[model samples]
Target: MPYFDSERFASLLEKEGFSASQAKAVINALNDVVDESTVNVTDDLITKEEQQKTIERYKNDFRQLKTDIQRMEKNDVEDVKSANERLKADIDKLKKTLQDELIRSQAGVRLDLNLEKGRIRDETVEQHDRLKNTDEKIANEIQALKTQMQGIKMQILRYMIGTITGAGTLVLGYIHFSH
Candidate 1:
């Protein structure tokens, strides 16, 4: 406790030119003086009333230290609670931020889908219109072809009637002349 290593003390004394025996004797003498002083001081300090007083002082100090420790523990608990509350708040804020971002992305996706649906509907309507126009054109073409076919059929029937009339007239004239 007092930085007195015996070997170091002896070596230091020898370094100062004391022979080994002188060094050992000096160290011994110093030890005896120190021990006597310590004994006298300890005897004075160990009286019954003084010892009781010292014990009472130590007890009081121990109680004070216990109170301080309890106070420090209470303060530490409060600090931990406050830190937890702050951490919870931060987590809640982060959750809200993530939720908001998610909602925004969802809305963006919905908007995109709606726009795509509109475009698809417009294309469908345009294709339907084209189909309708094509159908009407095909119907008109069919009607025109039917009219041309009927006209050609009537011309052929007229030519056949004219040829049959000429043949019947020649047969009648021949029979009358022969009779």
Candidate 2:
């Protein structure tokens, strides 16, 4: 079943010449007074609850038919003859109802599947874009870190060279003075 948004319904009612407040009041009343169980099946509108009940009833009938079939298979000749006839009739009725309900349920299933698929696709695209942007930011940060590390390494090398030269000069001066 399609989602029912009260705001959208009210907007539609207002567009049809009802005052905003009046539209809201009417929509509220409609929501309060509508009894799904009391709906007439012959009418064009099938409430969600009614459809669900029908599907459940069909499922139950099908289960009973299966049980009956099992019983017939285990019975004596006389019992089998009578039970088989009843089983056949019950099976036929259950089959017909099940087929009809299956078709109806399939229609709802198809609609739900389409909506879910669209939602999934949209989320996937959004996630892909977010990941791409994040990856680019990380890559830029990594490059900046590499440059800073190289600069720090160069500074350390310069300090080490200066220290080594100063030590060697001091040693030579001491040896020359002692001689």
Candidate 3:
């Protein structure tokens, strides 16, 4: 608080043409006003030292929180990397499995084709053998028929010659009897 010399203030007001009693009364009233306007210091307001300590504590807490957040982020990144590696391994396995299945399928198809080809070849050979046997049987039957026809032709020729000879003999006997 600044020093307020009431006597000096009263002297100055008296020099300004106020009476001594009025000057004293004015000084008393000013003192009352000053006293009324002044703020009283109390325990509710904190000291600078206490404020500095609180700020330090808050700074420390903030640093710890930052560290914790960084650690959590690093762990999350590692987990993501592990999961990515597992996915890559699974994809590789699936590709290999698909390739193996394709190979097996192709091999099975090839085996079936080979078996089918063999079966077709056997059937074609059997059909050819049957046709050959049928041709041979037909040839034999044609030869037997030709032989039988030739024997019948020879017998008819011999019978025709014998009848002609008997007719000639009868004519000769008739002429001799008439004579």
Candidate 4:
């Protein structure tokens, strides 16, 4: 709200060659216009303190959001790392099992050959074919597991990137609005 200094305004108008009555008339008219046109706008406007409080609230919220996101990211990464380790352990276990199976198979074939010399050749060939098939199946399974692990890794990377991008956007928004 601005004050209308009618006295000063009338004095100025009189000094500028207006008659005293003319100056008074001009001042009265200006006063009327001011009274009609001006409205009390204080209730509708935000005080600086209120604005500052709002900004502070937003900053706190932003910080909490950032912390939560970071925590989630760390947890997600740890989970992926642990999952990778488990998969590797599983693969190692599978390899050991395959080796054990092969050794057992060889021992069995040898025993059969000793016990049945006449049919030893045919049994050995049959055992060899079965081992080959098992080996192929295991290899294919290992390859499939590897592919699945790769896919999981890629998915985690994409999620991390998207989260980082979202966090960056929030940071930029905070910066823009703070001022």
Question: What lDDT would each prediction earn against the true structure?
Answer: 0.69, 0.66, 0.68, 0.71
- Global lDDT for candidate 4? 0.71
TM-score of 1: 0.42
Write the residue-wise lDDT of candidate 4 on 1-179 in tens digits: 66768888889998999999999999888778776665445556788999999999999999998888767666766666676677567667866776676677667656654655544455778766665665566567657756866786676677667656765665665556554
Local accuracy of candidate 2 as per-residue lDDT tens digits, 1-179 = 34679899899998999999999899878776664433544377878999999999999998897677545443533453465567557656855775676577556556755665566577877766665565566566557656765785576567556555654555565456445
- Segments of candidate 4 deviating more than 4 angstroms: 1-5, 8-29, 32-41, 110-179
* TM-score for all models, in order of appearance: 0.42, 0.30, 0.52, 0.49
Task: Find the candidate with the highest lDDT and give its number.
Answer: 4
The TM-score leader among the candidates is 3
User: What total of clashing residue pairs does each candidate reach?
Assistant: 0, 0, 0, 0
- Candidate 3 clashing pairs? none
Tens digits of per-residue lDDT for model 3, 95-121: 577567657755765675566556657
TM-score attained by model 3: 0.52
Candidates ranked, most accurate by TM-score first: 3, 4, 1, 2
RMSD of 4: 8.3
Model 3 is weakest, by summed lDDT over 10 consecutive residues, at 170-179
